[model samples]
Target: MDAIPFLPLDPLSILLLFVVGFIGGMVSGFIGSGGAFVLTPAMMSLGVPGVVAVASNMAHKFPKALVGAMKRARYGHVDVKLGIVLGIFAEGGVFAGKEIMTRLRAVYGDTGTDLYVSAIFVVVLAVVGGLVLRDALLNRSSRPAGTRQALPAAARWVRSVRIPGTMMRFKSMNNAEVSLLLVAPLGFATGLLAASIAVGGFVGVPAMIYLLGVPAIMATATELVVAFVMGLGGSLFYAWEGFVDIRLAMIILAGSLFGIQIGAIATTYVREQLVKLVMGMIMVVVLFSRLFKMPVYLADLGAVPALSPSLHGALDALSVATLALALLAGAGAILIALARGIAAHRRRHGMLEPAAVD
Candidate 1:
């Protein structure tokens, strides 16, 4: 293997990474696995190599995920056995994901790798985001606090078709033990996404909720355990391949630790419905972030007509703007929920203290 060229951090880039990391961490904490979706793209925008951006993001994730899992556990939301079972399978998927990335890089270089990752981002985010968003709209209730949503038809179907040898009970789901057959693919996909772009929670959490019948709150919390397991395993593989950038990883991790705590606590205040709504909305918004940049990669690879330099720059700018909006939108929603939660908590206790951001 050869020494990978790590991007030199300018003052501006360092500051940018710190801010992005904090926001990303907050999102991750609340949703159980989102920071990497933003962090990887943000690093790539700063002239970091495609593989290195992903590698560094994965390296930063395990510690943050560990913190998040522990925090959410206090709320009695985590399903440890379920998470561990899923994560072990996810580890295999991570290995497969790295192979896919490395091969793409070797053949078509960074442009190829970026194109592949960006395409997946667009497709996966759009489908999952749209589904969750629609579900939120349809399921709106008068209740303030979130309750476990009714199981989806798919989940019911999955639970009914029990494989005699593969059924395993999970406390997160009410009755029916899901089959290992179903879990294997979902876990693998989660790990694959985690390795590919360091954002597997998007898939893992939703699968647990809509397919396996886990409640939204429990799904988000339990995914952290899966994340911790996969992130640790993925980092070792990426580091061995000389893709991990320690300096970049540490900076992001440092900022994210603080943000993750806030995000985790915010979860306690908000309704579970808001969790799905925010996760879905952010993914839909972030989809544009990738769409705006996809043409540039295609043109670079001669897969599409060449773009004028000015247009290319404009597309990149638009991508960055959308990414920023996604972060801000997520943060704003979490904070609002936190404020409302705090006020409600106070009202119930008949406390005299004024409400404030924690």
Candidate 2:
């Protein structure tokens, strides 16, 4: 087999990718949809070819998702059968997405390819992320802290649709028969977005939570199952095309596994709504970071003026800063939440000890 050339192993790049993967993994484990948003772009900035960056990221995603999902399943959050059914559709969508990407590349070359992807990321994140953030904020503002666990309006609407013949019962859906017809379109769209942006769970997890009546905790955990299925199929296709970068995949896997383990265990104690709110905030910020890149791509495709060199530099710096901020904020939130939960657990145990003595 012909070997693909490796990007020269720079210590800085390796360190950066590992750090990026670690934080991204933590976010994915906690929130269920952020590794590739950070990983693929980080690699691309280090001069990995776009497709290779995506392919390697996809390869890493399957195992990480598998581990995370299994861990969350033990916590009683994942709906195995529902995730599988949705995943099968997502898998088929991955093939379709790959074909679209291939055709787009054939026609438009590298610049167009970049433009198309950045645009999709910006648009999807803007709409989806905005809704998520809005809902989170609304929840925080309107409800008392102790009683803020109800589904959002979107979930209520979805449950009320009552589409006949399309309802299927899933243990994760509280044994309710949710509309698979609804799930299919959502899953397929997620797959297409995954093919485009390398992270479909951004859409998939949120959709499950806000639109499909799943709890935020369950939605985030279940997204890993979907990610595993889609990533497995995506990896096979990329491997067939000889695009897998095993070294990068392994490096990312190393850091991500540690992060996933921490995140999985942390979820057992943190408030689920807080996790959802934090994830929602991160999504909105990341959406803008991608949006910042779209103008450059628009210029490349002749849809906008070539930005002034200084202006472009400023935008690039701002985008990087925003992305870094999002990563730090997310990781920090998870760690803090985890620590608080752990401390609370210990305090409760201490209280129980006095009662035992009595």
lDDT of each: 0.88, 0.79
- Provide the lDDT at 318 for model 2: 78
- Find the 10 residues in a row with the least total lDDT in model 1: 349-358
RMSD of each: 3.4, 2.6
The residue pairs found clashing in candidate 1 are none
Q: Report residue 301 deviation for candidate 2 (angstroms).
A: 4.3
Model 1, position 347: C-alpha lDDT score: 92
Off by over 4 Å in 1: 1-3, 141-148, 351-358
- Using TM-score as the measure, the top candidate is 1
Taking all chains together, each candidate's TM-score versus the true structure is 0.94, 0.92
Q: Write the per-residue lDDT of candidate 2 for residues 86-200, one digit (tens) a residue.
A: 7888987788877766666667655565666667767777787777778778777887877747766877777777887888887766787678777898899877777666889
